[model samples]
Target: QQQVKQSPQSLIVQKGGISIINCAYENTAFDYFPWYQQFPGKGPALLIAIRPDVSEKKEGRFTISFNKSAKQFSLHIMDSQPGDSATYFCAATGNQGGKLIFGQGTELSVKP
Candidate 1:
């Protein structure tokens, strides 16, 4: 299996603090990278993403920082909230195969 490595299996952040999760892949063919947020008993949904050509993308308090050469990316949540607690997954997809490769999920907790 093409593996995407993730760090800090779990993370704890205080409300209003920042939450960050990172992932790295070795596949050079992967072009699309997206971060998904999954709440308990719910399916994961796209949170933020960036192409290899872009260095960063931000929406609201969420940001995706990409490094093409390093084949790595990260998700940053500014001013995290208790409601932001969820499982985050980093995924990569290539055009040729159309398979989405996911990193080990990161569990984030925002303490009130």
Candidate 2:
């Protein structure tokens, strides 16, 4: 029950449109949920994260909505831009755990 599932293998959005990506997990032990964004030929960087105690978190144009009872989470990008084009991944880890259970990445493209 440590698996994280993500959907919308690819997404295309207009520059001023909204981009939404979803993720779900099976392990209730997971405490930390972090989203990462990766560009071509580069390492993934942390975008935003949330703990189980928090229902939602937002930073700049990125927002994460978490549902503890449903064991699901989603990432919403407001005012999607061409600069936001990248591969995003959602990951989860338990308390004091170093290994992150990552979801299948969702490739997002924002057209100018």
Candidate 3:
């Protein structure tokens, strides 16, 4: 079965702190990993993405650290803010018709 397991169903971070979310995958067919951020009453948006070729990718305060050998990846939010309070999801998809598998999801709350 193809699936991604995510940790910390809910997280609480202080403003200006770092928020970390972890995920692991079971499908080797997956070649692409993407993180999505969803605000209340809004659909999820692509926050960042990574491939097996890279160990890490950073865009502004959002960074994705990947471990291909271990089949794991993580998202780090630097300088966490209340505005960042949203549900985060880790997903994976491969060349097999581009079927995407999503993790359980993590609801992150940034407290001021």
TM-scores for every candidate against the unseen true structure: 0.95, 0.97, 0.97
Off by over 4 Å in 3: none
Give residue 46's lDDT in candidate 1 (0 to 100): 91
Show the lowest summed lDDT stretch of 10 residues, model 2. Answer: 93-102
Clashing pairs in 3: none
Cα lDDT over the full model 1: 0.91
Task: After superposing candidate 1 on the true structure, give the runs of residues whose Cα lies further than 4 Å from its correct spot.
Answer: none
lDDT (0 to 1) per candidate: 0.91, 0.95, 0.95
lDDT of 1 by residue, 2-112 (tens): 788887799999999999899999989888998999999999999988888889999999999998888889999999999999999999898757678888999999999
lDDT digits (tens) for residues 51-109 of candidate 3: 99999999999999999889999999999999999999999998778777999999999
Model 2: how far residue 16 lies from native, Å:
0.7
Clash list (residue pairs), candidate 1: none
Clashes of each: 0, 0, 0
- Per-residue lDDT tens digits for candidate 2, residues 1-112, read 8799999899999999999999999988888999999999999999999998989999999999999999999999999999999999999999654799999999999999
Sort all candidates by lDDT, best to worst: 3, 2, 1
